[model samples]
Target: MTDLVLRPMTPQDLGDVLALQAKGYPAALHDSAEAFLSRMALAPTLNLVAHDGGGLRGYLVSHPWAAGSPPPVDSVLPTAAPQDCWYVHDLSVAEAARGLGLARRLLIAGRDAAQALGLTRSELIAVEGAAPFWRRQGWSLPAIIAPELAAKAAGYGSSAVFMACEDIAAL
Candidate 1:
């Protein structure tokens, strides 16, 4: 972690961000550049990038969003709106950087940013069998989900599970 610098993500990082995303996620899960930029505009501090000697190695895109209302993948939010909790839209690390604990660092940074905004809860849609990984990070699935919400999760892809961290303090 000492060798990598964590900083607020800027438009300049999109190229590397997209490349890392492609390597880590299925095409169905990929967010368009406009979608990424829109979220960044709403919460610049929450969106972050990890830079090392090799260049940008990882990134996290999060924003202030209403809980239980995870936006569909690639949905571009054009303006500020009332928000209840922090939403982690995406987190990806380059294949070469996977073993270095970079993802954890980015998560911590994003969580800290959200906390700064007086937000205590966080939610994310875990796609591609990522539930176990998020669970290990202290997020958990609701015991039961509403039908409409379950259908919303389905839109993310077959294995997507809606998860939340009820207390960011615990993270």
Candidate 2:
């Protein structure tokens, strides 16, 4: 395996990141290159790219969310203490990079970023197929989810679990 470097994603890397997302996830979650570039410009630090010697290998995008609020579908929620919580929006590792802990590394990097911002917790909506993985990583379902988020997640069926990690180290 090649050495991996984690860096803030740039506009130039958007296409590669979108391609990787398409390869890793279904169309529903794959954003267009323009959309991703826009996101990178809006929240550069949270848009992280993992690169090996060849090119982009993986990427993760996390945004802070307000406690007791619905997950924002089009924008990050306004918060008095934005650092208190983080929402892991998307995490994707190239097929070639799977099973090598690259996803874990990207998630850990997001956790560190959240900690640096003074966040005490991190949250994500895990699809049914991802629940086991999140559980293994020390995340648990929260007691309540915002109605809007719940509605948005209806398509995921009843098995989708909203998981959170209170400690970055635990992840």
Candidate 3:
């Protein structure tokens, strides 16, 4: 593994972030620029990117959100919503950067942010058959979301699963 730097995402990094997103995920799962900007604005505390000798290698986007619910895909969120769980909106590692534990590092960073917010759990919608990766990171699909949230999760894909985890190292 090479030395890497993990820091907050910046406006200048959006181009690389979008490109990496396109390469890291399938077309159907790609997020719009507006959505990215909105997440950055509403949840700047948790949007992070990893830089190595080659440049951006991975990124993680998360936000404080309500449990049993997930914001609809490609949609902006209100700043006034009550938040009880740290929601992980996106996580990506470049193909060339895999095997370096970049994803896990980003996750741990997100987890730390969640813990900092005094939240006990973290949640995310797993798409592109990436549930196993998330599960390996200590997340679980308890089917804990409501019908409305479930419907929103479906927009990511037919097989998207809403997962949550209480293991962010504080426990």
Candidate 4:
């Protein structure tokens, strides 16, 4: 196995990150480079990337957010919201990097970053058939959710669903 390093994602990593995004997700699911950069700026400490000498492996985009109140897809918030749930906006591990536990490590990083940020929970809009994967990672589908939050999740796509990691680190 090749040695891989995890580090805070930087602007220099954006192009590769976007390319990895393309490989892991479809066009309709793509988030713009501007939005990705905005998310990194909003919560630098909560975001991370995995790489080796070969290049990008995966990236995780996370931030502090209100529990059960995820932001809309692909749009950057004009201002930061008060810290609450540590929201994982996206996690994508390149196909070649699967089975190496990079995605798990990225999520673990998000959970740890959430704890460090003083947030106890985490939320994400799981889309494109990723729900089962997240479920195995200890994320749960909320039994109930507000109409607005559910609607925001719907914007992700037909298969998108709202999931939360209660007491994030516990799992």
TM-score of each: 0.97, 0.81, 0.91, 0.94
Q: Which residues of candidate 2, in runs, are more than 4 Å off?
A: 68-83, 144-149, 155-159
lDDT of each: 0.91, 0.71, 0.84, 0.85
Scanning candidate 3 in windows of ten residues, the lowest lDDT window is: 162-171
Best by lDDT: 1
Candidate 4, residue 104: lDDT? 87
lDDT for each residue of candidate 2 in 67-119, tens digit (9 for 90 to 100): 44425333433333334577776788888888999888888888887777667
Ranking by TM-score: 1, 4, 3, 2
- Give the worst 10-residue stretch by lDDT in candidate 4: 73-82
lDDT of 3 by residue, 16-99 (tens): 999999887888888877778777776676889999888999999888888877888777777676678888999999998899
Across residues 46-154, which tens digit of lDDT does each residue of candidate 4 receive?
8899998888889999888777777776777555676778888999898888998888888888778778778888789999988999899988898989899889899
Query: Candidate 2, residue 162: CA error in Å?
Result: 1.7
* Candidate 1 minimal-lDDT segment of 10 residues: 75-84
Compose the digit string of candidate 1's lDDT tens values, residues 19-136: 8888888899889899989998999999999998988889999999988988999999856765789999999998788988888999999999999999999999999999999999
In model 4, residue pairs whose N, Cα or C atoms come closer than 3 Å (at least 3 residues apart or on different chains), thus clashing, are: none
TM-score of candidate 4 against the unseen true structure:
0.94
